[model samples]
Target: MTDMRVSIAGVKFKNPILVASGTFGFGHEYGKFYDLSELGGICVKGTTLHKRDGNPAPRIAETPSGILNSVGLQNPGVDAFCAEEMPFLKRFDTKIVANISGNTLEEYSELAEKVAAAGVDMIEVNISCPNVKAGGLAFGTSCTSAAAATEAVKNHAGSVPVMVKLSPNVTDITEIARAVEAAGADALSLINTLLGMRIDLKTRRPILKNNTGGLSGPAVLPVAVRMVWQVANAVKLPLLGMGGVASGADAAELMFAGASAVAVGTALFNDPYAPIRVRDELAEYCENAGVARVSELTGGVKPW
Candidate 1:
């Protein structure tokens, strides 16, 4: 059998297919559909220091081949997640990642310390959340803020590796990637949803109540691959590449572009079994291509 194992930072995964945060909802919801242990890992929903009610109604809107969301990091907060959610996910054999975001750097550090103490395998520092302290500018959009956020999480994350998630809405993503890497981030996950909006023709208003949302699904794959390729070459840190990934072929394409691993987000909203399907399909591709190990595909693309 072709080997599908991949190691990110210091955590070893059974495969390279992980469920993107927000879309997987902490694993319990999707566990009802299939064995959660079959995939590489699960990055739970975005959690904050305190509980969030999320944005108003119409938080999610459908587009041609993707969906836009302004869920506003809705969650039961870190305390509840540790006391109530962690035990359930710990039962699975896969790696567990807590995707944490906060309005302030202190909140980010505290949340990282809490989840790290609670024994999550990894912490995904979400700097893409609108910085309330900065009047709504996303932390990931600025090099200084992004590096500061990564340093904050790395400080309190203990033995758990910190993976900084990058926003694609910047002029130069590699600048942010290099900054975070220099700030001691153990890894990076890139191309978080692109900013997008849609209008209702009859009403002449935005479909989402939040006015704009992060777009994901098959539509953003090209952008994701390009960013992954760029960041992968820019920094020595490992990458969890995502955007418009729905199938094993899509996952393979990202790996070829330089993603050490790929996350399935919007696709999971449509197919609960997408993780396994993609995993199987990736293995099939490897076998057909005469590749013995899946890791061989990372940055394997040849320039014309």
Candidate 2:
């Protein structure tokens, strides 16, 4: 039998398939469809220090093979997540990762401290968030901001392992990856949505209220794979690869490219059972290939 288990930053996951943050929404809705324990881990929606209403109407736009979203980190805030959401999540046997975002370095530290004290398995610092303090420049877009965010979270996150989520909207992802690794990030997750826009020809206006939004789905798969491969070789931190993962083959591609584990995101909107399906398919893939352990696929790709 293939051993699907893998450990990242000392946290062992039952399998490599995890529901990406913002897609799983605390796992309460998806839990009704299947047992949440069936999967390896769950990344709760992005949470801030305080509640946020999110972007205005028309925040989603369906593209050719992907979707554009400007959800703007809508959540019940850090206090509410610990007070109300943790109870529901704790009942499950799966690993829970809190995806945290902040407008400033101090806010990131505060959110990390609160969530860490609340007993989460890991904290995913979402530096890809547009830094309001820096006039909307995404924190992940620069080495300085990314390293600062990682350092601040590490200082206040206590013992909970910190994973910095990298944004794809940058010139060199490797530079940012190395920067975070140096700043003391325990792990990394990459290829957050690519910036995109859809305009209505008739109205000559953007479909999403934010005008341009983050693109995610099958359309971004190739880009995700490329970025994962680059970051994997650049840093020693385990990577949580994502950005357009939809099937088992897709998951395998990311794993082979160098992701320690893979995350299913936009696919969840079309199929709620995606995580389980992908896990099963991945098992089948390993069985057919005669691989003893699924983790062996990490960085398995060879040069021509």
Candidate 3:
């Protein structure tokens, strides 16, 4: 039998497949689709210190092989997550990584502190949203902002690990990854949707109500894998690879590319049970290939 377990930041994951934030809304809805205990973890939607109504209607637009979304961080806020969701989440039998996003460093810290109080496995600091005023810009666009935001959260997060999620819109992802590393981030998750747009020829307008949206799906797999490899090489931190992960093969490819663990985002829309399915598939593949541990596949690929 194959050993499918992997450890990141000293925390053990039964498998490396996790559902990315925003794609798997707290796992309560998807729980009806699959057993949450089968997967490694679930990174809940982007939650701010307070609740948000989210963007206007028609926020999701379908592309040729992907989807563009401007959900605008619509969530029940951190407090509700702690009070309403956390109780059930605590009993759900899987690790929960609460994803936090805010407009200021103070907000990020406060959210981290609150989530730390909520008793979760980890905190995923989301600095990629465009709607947020300050923290979003500083944490995602520049090395300064990224490090500052991460450091602020680290200071307040206590024992819970902070995994900074990097935006793919940056020019040199390596610099940003290095900056976060220096900022004391325990791990890194990369390639949050690429900025993209889809226009209607007959209507002469964009498909999404927000005009432009974050593009995610198979169309982004190649680029996402490349960025994961680059950041993995740039930092010693565990890399949570995400982009257009749709299948078990894609999850393995991310591990081969340098992701200690992988996140299934857009693909969840198609298969709500994808997170667990991917894990099972990985174990099967590892057993057939004579691999001892699935984590050994990380960065196992050789360059031509």
lDDT of 3 by residue, 107-158 (tens): 9999999999999899999988764444654579899988989999999999
Rank the candidate models, highest lDDT first. Answer: 2, 1, 3
Name the 10 consecutive residues with the lowest summed lDDT in model 2. Answer: 129-138
Query: What C-alpha lDDT, on a 0 to 100 scale, does residue 3 get in candidate 2?
Result: 96
Steric collisions counted per model: 1, 0, 1
Model 3 lDDT on a 0 to 1 scale: 0.87
| lDDT at 130, model 2 | 38
User: What are the RMSDs of all candidates, in order?
Assistant: 1.4, 1.4, 1.2
Model 2, 16: alpha-carbon shift in Å? 0.4
Q: What digit string (tens of lDDT, one per residue) describes model 2 on residues 221-292? A: 999999999999999999999989999999999999999899998999999989999999999999999989
Candidate 1: list runs displaced more than 4 Å.
130-137
